[model samples]
Target: MERRRSFPDVLAGVVFILIGGAFVAGSLGYELGTPLRMGPGAFPLLVGAVVAALGLAIVVKGLVAGEVIAFGPIPWRAVGVIVLALVFFGFTVRGLGFVPASLVTALLTTVASKRVRPLMAVAVAAGLTLAATLIFVVGLQLRLPLWGPWLGF
Candidate 1:
């Protein structure tokens, strides 16, 4: 019989606990009304408490009988591409219009993976653009124009 503590599990649990605790503390600044008339702080306070409790449970599990798992190598290229895509989307969304900006961003992110073909990337990007348009513009009824002034629309 062997008892081994998982470093990764413990670290993750600690991080979660810290984040939850911070949220809980921050929420205290706002008014937390009664259950019937819940204020702005109530939701964050409750969620933070739950997260902290979960983190504590994870820490306990890690200490008792944690399974050994190896951390995989970081995907630097994918990370870079995704970040770039997000930045591009943010910077160009207003000028390029929602459809064009989202399309380019989705395409960039889709092509970040080495296995994705050009055609597949474009298809995925188009689908994503359509879905985003439906969700943000149509469904939510956002005031953003489909085609911006930069596109002569």
Candidate 2:
């Protein structure tokens, strides 16, 4: 079988490599100590080198093996809905409280999926709220209100 270059992987590898380079560059501003007592720059620089290496590997693979990925259509609605849900969560978390904010966000994101029914969304939201409350509030003991000022709590 004839091998072809993988353009998508190459692109992703390049992006990762660039991001790693940025991390390394940014970390350079901070003082990096020795291996025994590593500084802020140490981690970032190491991550950057790893990213660059991975990118280089991908580029090499693309050059040697012919593997191409066809770009699929983007899911605009789902992306928009998830992003909107996060924005909503950010705005309402303090006011509405953790449970409500999580519920709303989970519900919105779930509903964004075409396969999810209204009842299913509510169920998922409720489950998410319960789990979040138990894990964050009861388990981890985060200093966040369950219900906010609106509920007179």
**Best candidate per lDDT, number?**
1
lDDT tens digits, residue span 11-71, model 1:
8889999999999999999999999999999999999999999999988888987768786
Steric collisions counted per model: 0, 6
Judged by whole-model lDDT over C-alpha atoms, candidate 1 comes out at 0.91
- The lDDT for every candidate, in the order shown, is 0.91, 0.87
- Superposed Cα deviation of residue 148, candidate 2 (Å): 0.7
TM-score of each: 0.61, 0.65
For candidate 2, report its TM-score. 0.65
Model 1, position 46: C-alpha lDDT score: 96
Q: On a 0 to 100 scale, what is the lDDT of residue 118 in model 2?
A: 90
lDDT of 2 by residue, 1-153 (tens): 577777787887789888888888898899899999998888888888898888888878877783767968888889999999999999989998998899989999997788888998899899988998999999999998999887788
Alpha carbon lDDT at 21, candidate 2: 81
